[model samples]
Target: MPEPIELHHQGVERSIGCYLLDTDDGPALFDCGPSTTIAALKVGLAAEGLRLVDIRHLLLSHIHLDHAGAAGALVREHPALQVHVSEIGAPHLVDPSRLERSARRLYGDSFDTLWGELTPVPEANVHVVGDVVVGLACFPTPGHATHHVSYLDDDGTLYAGDAAGVRIQPGRYVMPPTPPPDFDLEAWQRTIDEMDRRAPERLALIHFGVADDPQRHLADLRLELFDWAEFVQGGASEEEFIAYGRAELADAGEDVAVYDVAMPLWQSYRGLARWAETR
Candidate 1:
């Protein structure tokens, strides 16, 4: 049997999407969480019977801190590490100024606390994924972040960042992470179509664990997004819309997840303001 891929989730809330994927060449890490959560991730990794230095590769789904926040610090810690990210996002990884500026607006002073200091991923070590069959692949899944890209493992599993939307559980509902500036509805749908085209048997969402039913979950996600779009396109005030979204959450009534778009998740909209703007 192929060596089972080990997947562990850490720093979900702090925007740190930490995962360890076991491969034949050795073990690989998906995204390392923020600096603070690095310890937590290390602990989690150890629990799986591994350590930080054991990780041979670090693959990122996108450039957003929550997803790739600790990449620089990680590279700092393990000097020989190789980092892979989307071409669109690779430059920002090497020079996080633009990434930092945008995040500062959304996070203010707490950006450091939530994501740790984003250091630059050395350009020499960065690869702008241009070919697939060569191994790991980057699938453009914009709208969440114009620079966003997700990873596809040869096993037919997708490490989909915000491209597939956010859900608290596998067999659960989805809500857009709609945080500000670059959420394009048009791009998002096309990305989803592309995702379905790949026919991934499993999905690893940054917010939570692996999902087995991609089609069902995607269907649910589309409905919720439309619900939000209709609320916006139909002329509902922000207050009414937020309240309405909450009410809709109440209606879903499964393993519940309700984020106050008005209240935010971290410091800015907490993730709500951007979501509202996207809507």
Candidate 2:
């Protein structure tokens, strides 16, 4: 029997976890996490009676170190593996210079320790998902990153790459992942409203699992994102907003597994903060 795709939980940073899918096409890891989480991913897959070598496709939401710092590493490890990413995000994976430089600004010396060496995915190997759907459409999500994209599957489950916002609490509280260089509240809401029209049954977030209650998720996300934006716009500086955002985000009461999937959601926090400053 060809097994259905399964979402494997690779807990990252004591707070977040990565969601990988196991399909008949072969295992597909959505995001790699900071290189630190690969071991956890392997462990998660093993528990499910699988292994990393089973991964033939690495579908990246974006090229942020947290989402795909190990693209090169993965391809290196699995020579036959290919990567699927947004057209806008394809070059970074193929070149990785801007990606590395940006990460350096945020993580300095710890970048290497945290994200391992990242080389480019060969042009021939890069799959640039523009707006079409290979069973999933690339929905533009600007609040998170200029090149951020949310993948919507046929069943209406949107793989919201920080697009629908961050939901770390069980009661449905959400805050914008408006990391800098691309935090456009106007665009963010517009995108959400568009997704809302589609009425997805669930939202698969990069930092965690799925959100089936789209309305509650959208409502909570809309309010909180703007709230954070207003808070940051008030008087806090970039450094201050990041420090404050991290502290505030901790109060979210979801399963540690929710956060366990991705650590230092701070990477998003830092970027969102930058967006706040500009807006």
Candidate 3:
């Protein structure tokens, strides 16, 4: 089992995390949280008795800042580090101007504080993933984002970014992180099918912790994703949708604030609304 190193985004616990595992080649990180949390990330790494340079590879699930924002910074410090991402996400990592602009527009004033710097990864350091990366089986797991992908370890641990949804461990409620610009219900359903087919023994989620039950967790995520999509399609207001999400979390005995920080309900609503509009 791969234990996650909590980055503690915005001082919130279990809101964002990354995993460090031994790959066939060497030590690799499943995801590196945003630059704002880099100090905390280093602290976590030091606790594990490994320095940044000791990590040879960074296996990114997507170009999303929260998942891979520290790519360039890490590479800059340790020139030997290699970053592996989907082909669709490769260009963005090399030149993050467009991605930064999009994210700035969405985040506005809080952009810097929330995500810190968006540095471009040197072209040489970026490796587009194929069927296999390091030692894990790499496969497209789009839905959370068009460029999203997941890595399956030999031990059946899926490095499921946001594709498997957000479920703060110890809390059973699974919330789909359907962020805008690429939230497709049909596509995500297919992704769910694909994940089920893979049959991972455990899911390594970036939002929080590792889930031991892949089947049940994925099933719950599928149902909640459809339910949220339908709710948005039916014209549920953002406030209503947020309340609905909070109610679910509250009922599950989970800390609403922690889950909110991990995956904002408003963003999910906007994504669902956009998808609904297309329909």
Candidate 4:
């Protein structure tokens, strides 16, 4: 097992990351960056003496554009590539028209520019697995998205997509990426507890790098989720939520670049607010 290489996109250090893992079967990539970042991914792979077509397995945390947007294009290019994703998210990846429409409601005109065109992945290339991948274990870690999954490598490293929220570093705050429709607080809490039970020694966060302190990271994220949920339940408007989020990020010394992407504070407020109303 080779050490995971982080592919920083668009010259941004910590905005979005695509991780490459070398396995016995072949070179595998976890979470292809959004379609817009495909060129950067190509560059990253070339530096490693590999190419996009060289990737045999693509492990997606979910079908969210930021995480798996490039998957379709990659699959189309790499004939032998197999996509390992949650069963719930598989259908959407096969035909992303519905997902694209939903995202348009949120992102408006910038949708295509930010995420690029999402192509349909062939069904034959899809591999729906449960809590495991290539000898590693995968946990159905929902809450961030109904279709989200987290992979735990044999070395006790948890590839926590959005399951652990956005923690750029140990000193930074763990901000929840709660989006509309499927941000289940109950399930997310349960997922957090499950992660705690597993007690991974290190966490490989998709937002950026890895963290050796899993316990502290999970504890902080759990608390942050509760705090944000309660705050949103108080009926704060989107503007207020953004203001609050900006302040919090500044206080914690996190890069405000996170706000520039799809998982902004407004989406978090909306997701938590919806969860509060229904649950």
Tens digit of lDDT per residue, candidate 1, span 105-188?
Answer: 877886776667888888877877664513666667886777777778888778886787766553365667666667666777
Kindly report the root-mean-square deviation of model 2 from the true structure over all alpha carbons. 4.1
* Model 3 per-residue lDDT tens digits across residues 193-262: 9999999999999988999999999999999988998899899999999999999888888899998789
Residue by residue across 1-279, what tens digits does model 2's lDDT show? Answer: 111122232323323445566434666766666565566667766876777778777777777776777788767777787788887899888898887887788778977766677777788778877675454666676656667777766666677767776665343556566555666778878877887887888887654457778888888788876776676667666567656655665665544344424434455555555665565
Tell me, by TM-score, which candidate is best.
Answer: 3
Clashing pairs in 4: 131-138, 132-138
User: Model 1 off-target regions past 4 Å?
Assistant: 1-16, 254-279
TM-score list, all predictions = 0.83, 0.81, 0.99, 0.94
Model 2 regions lying over 4 Å from their true place: 1-14, 22-26, 169-171, 237-279
Q: Which of candidates 3 and 4 is the stronger one according to lDDT?
A: 3
Positional deviation of residue 247's Cα in model 4 after best superposition, in angstroms: 1.3
Model 2 alpha-carbon miss at residue 174, Å:
1.5
Point out the higher-scoring one by lDDT: 1 or 3.
3
The local distance difference test score of model 3 is 0.92
Score each candidate by Cα lDDT.
0.67, 0.66, 0.92, 0.82
